[model samples]
Target: MKVPFSPPFIDQDVINEVLSTLESGWITSGPKVKALEEEVCKLTSVSHTVCVNSWTSGAILVLKWFGVKEGDEVIVPAYTYSATALAVIHCGATPVMVDINEDFTVDTSKIEQAITNKTKVIMPVDIAGWPCDYDAINELVNAPSRIKVFNPESEKQKQLGRILVISDAAHSIGATYKGLQSGNLTDITIFSFHAVKNITTAEGGAICLNLPESFNNDEEYKLMKLFTLNGQNKDAFTKSQAGGWKYDILFAGLKVNMPDICAAIGLAQIRKYNDLLLVERERVARRYQNFFSQYSFFQLPILEDKERKSCFHLYALRINSISEEKRDLIIESVTKTGVSVNVHFIPMPMLTVFKDRGYKIEDFPIAYDNYSREISLPIYPQLTDDEVDYICTAILTSYKKVIQSND
Candidate 1:
């Protein structure tokens, strides 16, 4: 049996939604996009949400809105996907890479040390759908000592008087922390709807606005919508209305708006996610946990604890006491069995772009350790129980073969 990793869960419902959008004839940032944003708002309980073409776009838009510019710094985990750091780079700011905890989330303690007056934002990624410690992070930014060091250069920054927290929740839409959803856990959170994500719009994302009460999320939503459409006061949907043809460009903004056609796909998936889809994902993860626990070499990922529950986006299983070379060989062996797997990421510091920017992988030992041993297993709504069993069996057999050969 051939097992594919993380295929988008496209069904008749998704098809119908797309068909409906096509039939409507208004596909570009129309009612479907608005509806998808509303559904996300409901799921996350955030006051407002703005849909964008991609997570990177949403992150850049948010950073720009906060006035992050040259000489500014944004703190991010070295263990995350490159998009997190790339967003900061696009805004002409430096990405201060921090080490991650064993659970794969950013180390909050390490983050405090990285803070400087130039620090404008702290982007904590929910690696593998597990929520980070937002409470600690929020407190760290809001602490008097930290605030005293913060020298606000922009009007937006001065108004807040602290570093903004943006949750890179690309893999953790449904995840919960201390009874709060991932999107609502930070000052702002961005959820990805990429093809491989738990919720797919083919390629799309949403920015959940959960700023403090002093800030009007509704006004912020309007500004974000404008920013996604080249700073036009009116969107295509609104301009389609009679007498709305003429509009003003307030400022230069990125054209990263989500079209209705793409939003249709995610709308269908997210509507049923919490009830049926998410449950199945959790069930499959639990099965993997049960099967892998008996093996001495398997290090099961943390799915849940006393205060948090993951969305089970990626089943990042780690092989204990294995060198990076052995892990690659084991992956090769597993692939021969017709099972598709992947590594979550290589540390950002190890990547060419960041390496050239003076980042050393040695600075983030934990991030490197996590990346070396990590193997992301196939975990999605469509993966059947039998397929999962086959995958587990394939990995175990391949591991034994690789170990015996090396011995």
Candidate 2:
């Protein structure tokens, strides 16, 4: 069996939705986008949500919305996808990289030391659909000493009164933290619906707004709608209406709005989320854990606990104490068996851009340790029970072969 890494769970219902949207003749950011935003709001229990072209766009939008620009600093984990830091760079702000804990989430304890007067945003990534310790991270951001260090710029920044916490929740949509969903866990959260994500809009994302009391979610939502549409005061659907043709460009903004076609896919996924996608993923993850727990070589991903629940996006299996070279060989072995696997991320500092910027991987030992030995298995909703078994057996065989040859 050829087991592939994450694939989008697209069904006839999703196809029908997209077809309906296409037939309706409003393919741009229209009613379907609005409907998808509403569904996300309900799923996350957040007051407002704005669908964007992608998670990268959503992150940059939030940073730009808060006026995080040149001279500002944003704290992000070195263990995450580059999008988390690239957003800061897009704003001409400095991204101060921090290390992560064993669970692959940001280390809350190390966050404070990264804070400076220039810090404006604290972006904690929810890697592999697992929510981070938001309460601890939020407390750190609001700590009196940390607040004293924040130098506000825009009115939104001043209103927030302290460093803003935004979750890079690209992999985590249905995941929960302290009985709250991923988006609600932080001041602002971005969810990706990329092809490989648990839910797919082909290439899309949403911004869940949970800012402090000083900010109005409704107004924020409207402003973000404008931000995503090239600052156009009205959308295509609105202008198509009677006497709505007259509109104006509010200001220069990014054209990152999600089209109705992509939103149609998201609408279908969110509706069947609990009933199908989330449950199937959990079953696959549990099965992997059951099979791998007996092996000394396998270090299982943190599946779930009392304080949190993962959406079971990726089963990031780690090879304990393995060097980077052996890990690569193991991956090669798995591929030789016709089973595809991948790394969750390469530590940001190891990348050429960050490395050239003077960041070092040695400073993030924990993140590097996690990255070097990690392999993400296929855990999409459509993987049959037979395929799951084949994937597990293939990995176990490959791992044993690699270890034996090394010895």
Candidate 3:
């Protein structure tokens, strides 16, 4: 009856794949990584795809690729992980935090208000695996000129009037909104292959390039490759060529390339990944919804009327009719039953770094409110039907014990 949240669903196939990769004697960012990247491109319909060590590296690399420098601001949702905001800071850019819609995707309405001149990138996080209003976002990001800066003599000297749209598709790797996949919906997208994700590469990610018309994909991808590989103009494979070892350093780049060992696992996962993994996840989610839908305390997730199919990475249960104290009590109760639960995120501004940056919690009431009452239960491909039932019953029992007492 013990159910752990998001235990990776690795089978013998994934294990055998990695073991064979070890035996192959070519491990560091080689053919396997390229094959996986090509597979990702085929799945997501992205022009170019680059593999990195983690989702955080993919996100920051996107900003770095587009030349997001000091004094620039990148728009982000206040509800996402610290890595999302921290990545912006890594690029010497300020994270312009925005609120989310009631359904938890980034609020499109609030974006215009936050965009001033220094805004270099508008990063819309696909929170809880549901994509945002991309059409609306695109219209705003494309319309008119709005690139204000600190000094009139800055990177405006480099690229002008061209703000980028980056999608944090970490949770929505297999998700689609309005029939378009998450990666293709935005200008650039980053997908996570962390242990807990739907498709895991142990700890890895892919940066999918869908750049604007002005930038050439070849040039952009070349820079992306150089940036991830110690800023060298030539990678190790190229340098190993007979009498072809000469190259130059473009910028002080970050070493965040994905290894072939991780890619091997992803390759196996991607091969038979469709329908089988997603269908099981949906079935589990539906069963959880059916069990909890009748209760006043339970507000099941909406997939925006079936036009959008969430990857169902999580089913975020919210006790909105209760206090934060009661929410904590519920978590404790769930824990006592040998079933583990998790919170998807804590609002970034509440963290020490954002607090030091003068970000107040009250600014993003929706995100804070959502975080307080939310609890994400185990919804992986490995959970058995009986186990799901046990977990659901445990949740209902906890809700009754904690919330009824408070009521």
lDDT of each: 0.95, 0.91, 0.84
**Which scores higher on lDDT, 2 or 3?**
2
Best by lDDT: 1
Clashes of each: 0, 0, 1
Instruction: List model 3 lDDT by residue over 1-407, tens digit each.
Output: 67888888788888898998899887888888989999998888787999999999988877776678898888999999999999999988899999998778899889888987787788998877888888889888767545433222334224434567888989888889888877899778999999999889999999888876756777778788888987988877677779878988878899999999999989988876675787788888888888888887777777557578898888888876766778889999999999999987889999999999999889999998888888988888888899999999999999899967876
lDDT of 1 by residue, 143-196 (tens): 999999998998889888899999999999999999998899999999999999
Q: After superposition, how far is residue 338 of candidate 1 from its true place, in Å?
A: 0.6
TM-score: the better of candidates 2 and 3 = 2
* TM-score to true structure, per model: 0.99, 0.99, 0.94
Model 2: residues with Cα > 4 Å off, grouped in runs: none
Alpha carbon lDDT at 83, candidate 3? 91
Better of 1 and 2 by TM-score: 1
* Full ranking by lDDT: 1, 2, 3
